[model samples]
Target chain A: MGEKIMVKGTEAIGEAAIRAGCKVYFGYPITPQSELTEYMSRRMPQEGRVFLQAESEVATVNMMYGASSVGVRVMTSTSSPGFSLMQEGISYMANARLPAVFVDVVRGGPGLGDIQPSQGDYFQVVKGGGHGDYRLPVYSPSSLQEAVELTIHAFDVADKYRTPVVIFADGMLGQMMEPVEFPDPVDPSTLPSKDDWALTGARGRKARYVTSFDIDPYKLEQMNLVLQETYKKIEAEEKKWEEFMTDDAEIIFVAHGTVGRIVKSTVKMAREKGIKAGLFRPISLYPFPYERLAELAEKVDIVMTVEMSAGQMLEDVKLAVMGRAETPFYGRLAGVIPTPAEILEAMMKEIRR
Target chain B: MSEQVKDAILLASMPKALNGKEFTYCPGCHHGIVHRLVAELIDEFGLREKTLLVAPVGCSVFAYEFFDVDGTVAPHGRALAVATGMKRAKPEMFVLTYQGDGDLAAIGTAETIHAANRGERVTTVFINNAVYGMTGGQMAPTTLLGMKTTTSPYGRDPKREGYPIHMMEIMRALPGVAYAERVKVSRPQDVPKAKMAIKKAFYAQLLDVGFGIVEVLSTCPTNWGMDPVEASRWLEENMVKEFPLGVYVDKVTEVMKEKGVK
Candidate 1:
């Protein structure tokens, strides 16, 4: 077992990938995510791997594109606008069905909004962040330890589905230091055989071919159908949501990522007041746990969706409820992280309403 | 599972996978010649299994069909980025990006400069034809002065659109480039010399030297509104004058020679 140590969430991600046999790291410097790149730049070279500081956000993403195409485990980390610049590369990765891990340490943003911790990229990440008809499995981790563990698992999920997977966390998780006990690093040799395809030289296997262009609409539609079927399996198997103090609750609050931390404290305060409020925190944003929300909607009186952006995840919550209950939205736009007391007050308003 | 072919690739034999489809190239398009050159090097270096080609927009976006190994298509001007992701994800794979003027020069300028600037282990094959062929002859970033096209119909004046970009000079200027050269497929006679240049560039990357590029000066007869013979002749007289042929930077072999490693 590796010795226990205090590490920043960003550094833990780099260490985990290193143990997972990740051979290459490429990224540009951006606030909120500077540590991930900086950590990798120092560590990867020591591990006898490639670590490059790309010239720009676009170049960094493309460098990621190049490295991933050759069948190596690789990644890039960035804040909002940098992540926005990577949308095009992300879309191509999704379309090409290349397995890769992208870490978005989201900061506040409409455009260069601020470097403060924020979950404003919920919609951009869970939904396709690029201009394409696709979805990358997105994992949101609230804890430092989970950030490390989830990133390793992200690579496996990406390879299993032949899709890009994002370990979605924010500045708070990336920036703050914590005592992290990481699970065993994923062993690459034990993973599934991609010998049937992958460009790392077609040696010893039938020449593997991969491309996104399907001139035939029927073929493209078929590809989408196959992808949808795979995503459905993920939705059923990987949809994760944690419910806290839901028993005999009056108003149930749905939150994700950093918002869940605030909501947890909010639930405790409401329990003290006998306000009977609870929290529903989504771990997998893409799988969404919509069915769980629908099931919970029947027992709860009011449902409130709390977010860093203006109620992006609320749309999915409302869709899940399907008018079974009124899904009220409480959103704090970029920069200001919703506080526990602020969320409790908002839930009280929902209970009064 | 690969079936064994009797002869080794180093014996100057073509791989069984290459379906000899007569190339679909504009007359004198250096892409076809460069494709053959690269294919030959892949055969020579026994890299048919390990090398993957990524073709970009402009005329040869369908390069996936031409190369017998694994290949993928990227969105316009995003080949370098796509290539980056591919190489990063699978480091052992020998990746090469084949890009043209409009694709690499104008839109993908950032990607081009930075990939070299980063000295990515991947080799780049830059086809520097001066006009946009597939988009029906527009003002390519490398279009010569006074060169007429659909967009620059009244001839390209330096004052209006700026002079044609000399990519080799720019690539040479970057400290990160291991090798950079301007080669031409202008005359059928110059084919071997062009092939030599391509092989050296690819070999540099194969040995993990650094970013290497062989800019193959090409022609588009239809876009240039010249006959096939005239296009090649035009490249010899005009294109060669503006973009001089020879190695702009020979750092790759020099490094090896200095160490007596090769």
Candidate 2:
């Protein structure tokens, strides 16, 4: 354990990336997540690293592609609209199999909706947002401490799979401050060498080339199959979820990120009223813990999903439950956050039915 | 006669910096000429093992296959932004971008301007052929006001479409630009001058001064509806008037003098 220091969620992610040996950061300023870019601008020079404010989000993501092509750890931070602009580059990086990390401090959106926190990007992040067959590992953290830890872990996953990783935080998490104890900085020199695939001037070896383009349809299909295999392996090994007081509960609430923390309070309230409720939180949104959730659904009578969107995750909850339990959904839409009392009331209605 | 002719000295050959792969360009396309010039400069600088090329999405999309160095193809018009990242990540290595007019001036104008303004230590080779060649002859940002193409079948009119863009003029105005020049390879006599401009652009990056660019007024015979010789003549007569050939900016020599080197 290292010394605990107070930090905002966005700044903590910045420090965590630096500690994880991120060598380059290219980003454009947007609301709620601008602090991370500002933090990198001030800290990267001190650490002898590269930090550039790109002309726009479109340019920022391509810069990430360039840095990652050379086999270096690179990252960027953005809000919803900015994240939308990055979809094209993300598709390119995924096709090229470049390892990189991105932190999307999601705000309300259909188009420039609001700067307040919302999980409205659930569909865009969990599913393939760009124009292709690809999946990015998404980690959603409920608190500032977990955000710091996951930011470092996301880098490891990106390198292990050689694909882009997303830290799917919301605006509330970006603004909130918490005491976080960071791990020791990973010395970049000590990290495993990427010389085999990285473009390191091609000295003493054959020249290397990296690209996502193949005019031939048959060859492109083969490339996509390889990506599919990687995604399957990740699904098998990386599914993560948390359960609280579900051992003897008759009802369970499924939620993630900020909503998951709120449901924990709802579980306590339901338990006090002798309703026998518990909480199930998913940490990895892409490689969703479907199998485990199905098992829990078999044991419980009712599975309720709560979210900050109009029940985007509910579709996944329903798929996982698959009629094993009676499924119901409760949500607050368009930047509105639900309270524990309101969630508890919603759970009571389901029980009464 | 047999003894003297048997030991003749070779004057020129292919550059070692280029892989032996045959180019996919059409006959009389100036891409082949510009590619050779870039490769020659790479060999002269002994930077073959220390170079990274950011290929753009045009006829030169397969540029990585032609260059005997580490490289990647960026999305259309995003080459300069990608090169900026590559150079910043590996400052010890030489980085360059090869882009056509549509990719550089039309789609990627912001990336090109901001990268030059920021003084990113990377070189760019801009090919101004006045039309998009890969997707057929479409009207380009640099297309002449009276030129006709597949998209602009009725010769370009300033009332409907704007006048041709002069990228060299834009490059010269940027404070961070270390070297900017416009050159053409239409005539055999102009080849050496084109090579010199490209060599100076390479030095701009090697000397760690600032951004460098050389716009080559090239021709696309197939799209221009002219034979190879006629296309060359057309480039010399028309493109030369719209894009004057000369050094627009030359900070490389000043920096070289400051460093006390010739």
Candidate with best TM-score: 2
User: Would candidate 2 be rated incorrect, acceptable, medium or high by CAPRI criteria?
Assistant: high
Taking all chains together, each candidate's TM-score versus the true structure is 0.92, 0.97
lDDT per residue as tens, model 2, B1-262: 5755633421157788888799989999999989998998898789999999999999999888899999999999999999998988989889999999999999999999999999899999999999999999999999998999999999999999989999999988899999999999888888889989988888899898899999999999999999999999999889999999899999998887888865
lDDT of 2: 0.92
What residue pairs are clashing in model 2?
none
- How much is the lDDT of residue B93 in candidate 1? 73
Instruction: Give all candidates' CA lDDT scores.
Output: 0.80, 0.92
- List runs of model 2 lying over 4 Å from the truth: B1-11, B260-262
Residue A286 lDDT in candidate 1:
87
- Report fnat for all candidates as fractions from 0 to 1: 0.74, 0.75
Q: Candidate 1 lDDT, tens digit per residue, B213-244?
A: 88988888888888889888898899999999
The C-alpha stretches of model 1 lying farther than 4 A from their native spots are A1-4, A204-206, B1-17, B81-93, B206-209, B252-262
Residue B14, model 2: Cα distance from true site in angstroms: 1.8
Give the Å shift of residue B163 in candidate 2. Answer: 2.0
Give the Å error, residue B171, model 1. 2.3
